[model samples]
Target: MQRYFVTPAGLTETEVVLEGDDARHLATVMRAKAGDPFVACDGEGTEYVAEAAEVSPGRVVGRIVQRRASASEMRWRVTVAQSLPKGDKLETVIQKGTEAGAYAFQPFLSRRTVVQYDDRKEAKRVERWRKIAKEAAEQAHRGRVPEVGAVASWKALLAGFAEYDAVWLCYEEEGRAGVGLKPVLRAFGSSLGEGETPNLLLVVGPEGGFAPEEAEQAIAAGAACVGLGRRILRTETAALVALAAIGYESGEMGG
Candidate 1:
């Protein structure tokens, strides 16, 4: 079934209004008609199976059939803090991470980061990233879109350390003794009580990876350094691997 993200106001007591782009997509692109049932999510992370009550150029209405827990969201809320990569790699990270069940993407500029955001175009860039996240969430059947944070300097990101229940620093130079992803997640899982959810923060470096001093600073800030494996992963690959590992640990995917 096609899934779309609608505002809380869009999902009324018994109905959902497929407005603007969603309406057009449903009526013209998907050829949706009245009585066709589909799934949709509201702003509050509630999923509903609804039957189309009306389909037109400007609007497609769906009557709510049932409300249930969102299957797309992971049990733990994870925020991926990635060092800005060159080109449009950050976009790819946000898109894939959203599908992988990340709750937010925080792009930071590291010592090795080469991408310079043009001050005049910063707003537009952020907007495009947000749009990508929303569309990706809809495509992935996510209950809500992952937030794409504005690009920030490494120091700015470190200042928000207290917000996360646990922080994993994906630094490659941590050596053989570097904590493994499995153990890191296992520790987190053990800490949480049954039915408890914790917000996790993951830090991934850019194309050039983090400098020793940067890794030091993160470790000093209480972020646990966790290595992916013996193999080297590209900047874009690190977040995906981390998300997959988290999913496996959380039982969102098979262990």
Candidate 2:
């Protein structure tokens, strides 16, 4: 069954109306017709087993058959604070990172950042990133699309360290100390508030990586510097690797 994320406007008391791109995918690409069964998700973690009730050139209406909880989302919330990488690598990061169960993405300007988005063009870039995330989540059967946040400076990124249960800075030099991500996660678990779900933020540097002074400032802001094993991963690959590491530690993989 195909699944489409329904915005509030597309949802009604007992039916969903998918428009634009979703409608084209269903009505034209899928060749859907009345009574054809599919799935619909509301981005609020709700899924409906539905059947197509109406189909037009650019619209797909489906009647809800059954409702159920979305089990695809990770139990532990993970956000990737990625330093802007060159070219379209960030698009790849958002796509696969969402598949790997990252709940949000924050692209920040690092000391070594090579690309700069002017304020006049930043909104357009953010909009494009969000669309990429949405399509990726749907393809991966994710319950909700991971949010693509606006760009921020290095200092602005460090200011929110206390908001998460744990923050890990993926540094190339951290491997020398033999500090593993698993132990860092365990330590964070021990300190989390009762009844509160553990939340983690992984900070990945750009192509040239973070400057030493920036890493020091991040450490002082309550982020633990952790190694993603001994290999020097690319800026894009590092975030997904870190996410997988934490997911494995949480026992959420290989079930």
Candidate 3:
């Protein structure tokens, strides 16, 4: 069934009111009629199986059939902190990362970053990235949309390290030294207490990767410097690989 993320106001005791783009998509694109089934999520973990009750111009109302639990989210809330890469590589990361179970995306400007940070275009760009995440989340059957944070400065990124339970910085130097992600994740996983849901931050630098000092600062701020493997991954690829590793290690990928 098609899934739609509706706001709390859009969901009531008995109905789901999809408005704007979702309404248009259901009415025109999907050609949904009364009784057509779909799934609705409130983006706060509550989900419902519903059928179309009314379809009109710019509005589609769905009658709630039953509430269902969606086990699509990873046990760990892993946020990807990516340094702004040139071109549309960030878009690819956000899309693929969402499908791979990233809880959120945090874009930051690093020292080696070549793309100039433009404050004027920041809002529009972030908005587009969020839309990409939303579409990807829906396609991935995720109950909640991944958050796309505004680009942060290097210092700001480091300062925010305290917010997460653990931070892993993807460093090529570590990869060259033969340090792999598995052992680090294993150790971290072992440290978790019963019923604990860890907030993991995976940091990946830009095309040139992080500057020596940048990595040093992150480490000092409590981030664990880790490698994906012997082969260094592109900035865009690192986060997705890490997310997959997290899911597999957490048993979300199955035995």
Which one is best on TM-score?
3
Clashing pairs in 2: none
Which residue pairs does candidate 1 place in steric collision?
A: none
The count of residue-pair clashes in candidate 1 stands at: 0
Model 2, residue 127: displacement in angstroms? Answer: 0.9
lDDT score, candidate 3, position 74: 89
Q: Estimate TM-scores for all models.
A: 0.94, 0.95, 0.98
| CA error at residue 228 for candidate 2, angstroms | 0.5
Ranking by TM-score: 3, 2, 1
The local lDDT score (0 to 100) that residue 135 gets in candidate 3 is: 91
**Per-residue C-alpha lDDT of model 1 across residues 136-244, encoded as one tens digit per residue:** 9988889888888888889988889888898889977653565578877887888889878889899999888889898889888988888998778998999999999
lDDT of 2 at 115: 82
Clashes of each: 0, 0, 0
lDDT by residue (1-255, candidate 3, tens digit) is 889899889988999999999989988998999999989998867789999999975999999999988889888999999999999999999999999999999999998998888999999999999999999989999989999999999999999999999999999999999888899888988998877899989999999988898888999999999988888688889898888888999879785
Candidate 2 Cα outliers beyond 4 Å, as residue runs: 190-196
